[model samples]
Target: MKPVRFQFKLKYLAILALAALLLGNRGFRSLVRNYREYSRLKSEKAQLEQQRVDLEKKLAEISKKPAIEQAARTELGLIRPDETEYRFPAPKESDK
Candidate 1:
């Protein structure tokens, strides 16, 4: 009976020690932190990859002459020599 009690106590002690080591070890904490950081970085990398793909597609579109002219006219307010440009005032906002 004493040996059985000792074995049970030893098992409990081992479980407690393992729990303490897992919860208190610096390396284990760092590993958890690093895993979270790696996950966040992976998500950021995916977002950057998507952004790069979008930029590449935009670059391909703007590589064409017609797209270039459209971008210039829209972004730079440029008009062709034979075309007339018009400006309009913004509509007034009513007070609440």
Candidate 2:
């Protein structure tokens, strides 16, 4: 009778230990997932910072008067003072 009672207690303790181990394992997996997401967001933030710096440098360059004038002339086809301006009339549509 004594040996049977001891065996029952041992089996109960083993079951409790297994449940605790499984809970701990699940907690460890969740921690790993959170850490990976944190690292990915940090790297993306660094990339965005680099892009911002590059844009700021370009903005500084384009703030110059000469650069602004050159861009306007090339993009808008604008002319300086003393330059001749040509205007072409729109062609009329022919009767169908």
Candidate 3:
């Protein structure tokens, strides 16, 4: 009876060693790190782009005189001389 033995090819071992060496290299590690940073930056850019679009829409709305007047009257408690502003108190929680 003969026992089975595993035989590894020298060329395969050399290829595996080369791969491991490359993976252990600082340059390769830095490349991986830089790629991750680039991905993060891309995500941040998307968020900033969305924010910019929202701000542009707000700016466009505020550019109109009616929108500006409405915002001012509601936000700043402003009133025109010919208009009468009414005051009301919030209803009590118990009353609800």
Candidate 2 local Cα displacement, residue 69, angstroms: 0.9
Question: Estimated TM-score per prediction?
Answer: 0.71, 0.56, 0.74
Stretches of candidate 2 off by over 4 Å are 1-24, 85-96
13 Cα displacement, candidate 2 (Å): 16
Tell me how far candidate 1 lies from the true structure as C-alpha RMSD in angstroms. 3.9
- Model 1 TM-score is 0.71
Residue-level lDDT tens digits of model 2 in 2-95: 7998999999999989888777787877888999999999999999999999999999999999999999888999998999988887776873
Q: Candidates sorted by lDDT, descending order?
A: 1, 2, 3
Q: Model 1, 26-92: lDDT tens per residue?
A: 9999999999999999999999999999999999999999999999998999999998988887776
Ranking by TM-score: 3, 1, 2
Residue 63: error of model 3 in Å? 0.4
Best by lDDT: 1
Which of the two, 2 or 3, has more TM-score?
3
| Clashing pairs in model 1, backbone N/Cα/C closer than 3 A | none
Total clashes for model 1: 0
